[model samples]
Target: MHVVSARERLLTAALDLFAEHGVSGTSLQMIADRLGVTKAAVYHQFQSKDDIVLAVIDPALNRLGPIADEAEAQRGNAARREQVLAGVVDLVVGFRKVSATLSFDPVVMRLVRAHPALRNLQRIRRLLGGTAPDPGSRVRMAVIAGGLMMAGADPAVTGLDDEDFRDHLLAAGRRILKG
Candidate 1:
């Protein structure tokens, strides 16, 4: 049987709590309670609430790195853009709950901005919009990024299955980026 580590459990509980309550609103105690453990147990796994928050978001950010790398490896600009957009759509659709939680939270935004992993995001944006994007590409990139995040949480799209959502998102991203 597969065993879940204490740190993994703590990070999972923290992400759930962070999703339900914004990172600022969630406490170490809340994460502990979610996992049916003491706050000291949480501390044993992570030094502070900020540490827990970082641990929670780190994996999601890490996943983006490979997408950008794969996109960069593509032969042509259109192929690279499509590859990245498709990868992003798959990620957002597959992890809609986590995406929504990370994308919309104000505290998480602040933390992510200061995080070293923020370079992954900059790289993705540069890949999508070019090394030095014009104002129009900048606007398109912003809309595609924001729209991908919102697509995960938007109630209007909830009824659609993951494949449908991903396809629609990819189409919209293509239009925005290429048009």
Candidate 2:
């Protein structure tokens, strides 16, 4: 049987709570409660709530780093852009629940904006928009990113399977980037 680690359990509980209640609304004690553990158990694993928040987002950021790196290594702008879009679509679809929950959280957004991994996101945007994008390209990038996240949570499209969702999202991203 597969065993869940204490740290993994805590992070999972924390993410569920963060999704239900915004990050600012979630407390360490609440996380402990969700995990059916004492607050001390939580403290034993993480220094603070911020540490837990970072842990929750770290995996996604780690995955995104590789996507941007691979895209950057591509030969042409079209190839780089397509690669980044496909990779991002797959990432978002695969982690739909996590993406939807974290992307819309204001507190998480603030923390992520200050994170070092934000650089990778910027690199991806640059790859899509070029070295110095015009106002239109900037807007397009924002729309594509925001759309991808929002699509995951969108009830109308939730009926679609993962492959369909990924395909549609990638196609939409390509259309947006082409504009």
Score every model by TM-score.
Answer: 0.87, 0.89
* Candidate 1 residue-wise lDDT, 1-179, digit = tens: 98999888888788888878888899999988999999998888889888887777677677789999999999997788888888888878877877667777887778888888667777788778646557887778778888886788887887998888888998888888885
Worst 10 residues of 2 by lDDT: 129-138
Candidate 2 per-residue lDDT, tens place, 1-179, comes to 98999999999899899889978999999999998889999999999998998998887777778999999899998899889888888888877777767777787788888888878877877877745547887788779877875788776876899989888898888888778
18 Cα displacement, candidate 1 (Å): 2.2
On the 0 to 100 scale, the lDDT of residue 178 in model 1 is 80
**Model 1: runs farther than 4 Å from truth?**
130-133
Clashes of each: 0, 0
Give per-residue lDDT, candidate 2, residue 38.
92
Q: What lDDT does model 2 reach?
A: 0.84
Give the runs in model 2 whose Cα sits over 4 Å from its true position.
Answer: 130-133
